[model samples]
Target chain A: MTKPAYEGKQPSFFTTNAEFIVRSIRHSLRNVETMIMAIVLPVMLMLLFTYVFGGAIDTSGNYVNYVVPGIILLCAGFGSSSTAVDVASDMKNGIIDRFRTLPIHSWCLMTGHVTASLLRNLLATGIVILAALLVGFTPHADVWEWLAALGIISLFILAITWLYAAIGLVAGSPAAASGYGFALLFLPYLSSAFVATDTMPSWLQGVAEHQPITPVIETIRSLLLGGAADEHAWFAIGWCLLILIGAVIWCTWLYNRRAGRR
Target chain B: MGLAIEVKGLYKRYGSHEVLKGMDLSVAEGGVFALLGPNGAGKTTFIHILAGLLRADRGIVRVAGYDVTMEKLRVKMSISLTGQFAAVDDMLTGTENLRMLGRLNGLSAAQAAARATELISQFDLEAAGGKRVGTYSGGMRRRLDLASSLIVPRPIVFLDEPTTGLDTRSRRSLWDSIQALASQGITVILTTQYLEEADQLADRIAVIHEGRIVASGTPAELKARIGEEVIELLNEEGEVSHTLTTDGTITSIQDQLLMLAQQAPPNARVRLRSPSMDDVFLALTESADSNSNKEAKRA
Candidate 1:
């Protein structure tokens, strides 16, 4: 009785959203398999591309060093897609409805999932970086460059996390979300992540050179190699900003539409 | 008691199908009100609109003195909903689920911890509180779902078929929880297709059919409108041979029983029972369905 004690004092928006983010992160902790999956796929790809294809792929720089950034971004993509599946699962199981009915801000639900994705990617990316280092990969940048690379990676994670959030919302089921999400794993292969674009066949060269991930991988590669190419870095930042803006708007609209119908 | 919910001229349409066509309802505070309707009769739609999850095409809906649309924040703070499916996170422990909801509902971390503990103990989920919800039985999951709604105890709680798919014992236990919630002065709007559930838990019953309320009354009132006790005659094989209805007068009852006895097979036993809520609901909805059919033909 007596209003159950949550009356009079309202929870601030920041705390509520943060608390939900913690809940979502806790969900990942409870199911360590999800994080392991996020970590394992990228690391496995790292091992595959490093040892199996390292001799065949002729790059100017060390193959392991060049492949590390691409694998990190690829891991992020996989993680984001699974984030989509998680969101779709929550929607399917009606936890989204429960959140909608409660007093919290509606955006917090999506934000929570995104935050968890970011955390999982951070861990998975860190692990991939460590594995790359163990296999003779090295970074030539100073502290500022390292920080810049981290910032760029974090922004890239956030941008795609938002995109994946919308995908999760629009997807009908967990399987559909994963199908749509895992499909993004192919993106890194199309980018300049592995071999130089000049070496790729004529038909595949244009796609390899032009996709969003190419500039991002190039920017990270330049940052790790030493000073970044202003063109690639600016392009990467622009891509992240554009995708971030577009995904946030699309996610908000899609969520509102879904809420209205259901 | 004060009014907990009020609605007038509510309308909702899904494409060409109008689910709620000019629906109106009012519910008072501090008691259980059953919205009894079959599936797809707009029961879920009504609960959704009331809970502010879905937008109504047009309506003046209010919950806890705030308009559902214009005063969304206030309305949201005033109510909690347990959807038809148990919405507790299966990945988290039961205690974590409650604490998470509590925190989202604006409780401080400490308050959430204490409240989660209180609810875990109250729902008898102490044993399962630390275990992953995926490991829980259906009954435990349902209880945890209900407890999730009660984290901070909003003034009004909407239970959309809380006991659907539950076993008999689980259903009874949920009914007890609903009763306890009402006893604590929380208003409950329970939407159920189960007649027995409504009869046992609801203080007032609104029988909805075809998106419209065909009857609204207390259980006894609805049953009394049927105005007869049924006499059932069964043969030695326990198969019902004949059923008769009559007033409670001894002479009229005797006459009906004698006729039933004569018509029934040898060694038949007779028993009389009062009209139940199911009978009342069936009669009302059946009549409403026919009236709609007639109107359709006329149109």
Candidate 2:
């Protein structure tokens, strides 16, 4: 005979995380408003930059190619910001307390949110790239270069989404989480997302060039357009790895502390 | 039967406010136990500590023979908690929620689906089972929450204020569900404010007041300790105007009624009643309050 359903045995770790992932994905699908905003906002910004400002900024007509990489990152940032709100909402609800009483690792809660955000943001990134193509954005890249560009984008999304998930765990309320996440959306703008860093004033160039978002944007741009991709790739990978590790550590410590681990 | 839960000198505090002050309690296996307390009496805190959701400041807590602090996973596996609020996910359907918990508890997908269907029918939620829980009524949501927790019945179940805001009919239905669990030999620990709920459901009741148990006994034992009969003066509004305790003798009852008759108002009528659980609860908690106050003054 088959064993009873409530045999009181610990499930495998993969099954635990997979259940949470399914839950998070269902929530993302039901939340249509956030999903639409994540996709539409970046497409609108890409259109505005390509049509209105592309001519004045670049008389050579290569501005759309230059700006698509930054628009992709912006789409990622917008998509990942909702993860903070989702995490904070989970924390505030009694459902989290129920999960804590179960025999699974509570860190699975944040991992589920991070993984869902990564997939959602990737879809939004794909849509934004499609919109850029329609708006005269061109790139001279082989299939290998395309794979490299996609890899960097996925890594950046994973890192930022994890960071936002940690911020959600620390936030006392969903509104506060959204407000904090909104502050992070400004980092890409201050970096080399829209305009080149060299075009800014000398002092402002230092601020724009040194931030993590700048190297990532620069590396994606170089890979897509067949520019020199040696140095910027290392810096971009290093920053994403650093953020991902730090965020994972922070989430583990915070979840344990709040749940009152011995 | 073995002791399902054993707690001794359990103390918990938030900043300067002590929520659970040196409280101790125990329950035997395969019975219904009620923790009766008013709001803010630290009943939820005590339940959280026992479920391994919160750490006690200083205590020896063992659930199902495993120390809560030292063996958290074992204690967690041994117990299922339905918290004060309905913790069902709003986005998921009732069936989906139950299946998710089943999966989390290590059930196979087919087994989880079967269990979800069984619980949904057992809870009489067939009409609302397919809809998202956000659209469910408060009582329906609570039933779903309880069902989710029972996807895999552990040895012990802790329901913290399970039916606090439910209507009378809904409360009755939930009581039936709880009774079924107890009949299955699952040690069920529940907390409530209603004296009738405790008297109707619990095999034993513990009255907690100001972070300590002021009284503990069976329903009949608690009622018997107060007296045999009580003579009460009821006003026009059916409220008790005055009360007097009496032994089970005709003379003692007459004497008390005679004394009350002189002081009774024109709109007041006499009521002869048996000693009730309400009287025991009031007498126990009130005397506990005065005793603590006296201790405070002496110190």
Please report the candidate that would top DockQ against the real structure: 1
Give the per-residue lDDT of model 2 (tens digit) for A1-262. Answer: 0135447567789999999999999999999999999999999988888889988988888889989999999999999999999988888889988898888886798878988998999899888988888888788899999999999999999999989988887888899999999999999888889999899999989999988999999999999988898899999999999999999899888777765422
Native contacts kept (model 2)? 0.66
What is the per-residue lDDT of model 2 for residues B117-196, given as tens digits with 9 covering 90 to 100? 99999899999999999999989988998887788878899999999899999999999999988988889999999999
lDDT of 1 by residue, A1-262 (tens): 7454755235688987887798788887867787788889889988898888986784443688878888889988877777788778877887888878777776778888899888888888888888888988888988988898899999999999999888888898888988887777788888888877888898898988878899999899999887646999888999999999999999999888875553
TM-scores, chain A, per candidate: 0.94, 0.95
Per-candidate chain B TM: 0.91, 0.95
Off by over 4 Å in 1: A2-9, A59-61, A260-262, B233-236, B247-270
Listed in order, the DockQ scores are: 0.60, 0.57
Which regions in candidate 2 have their CA more than 4 angstroms from the true location?
A1-6, A260-262, B236-239, B247-255, B265-268
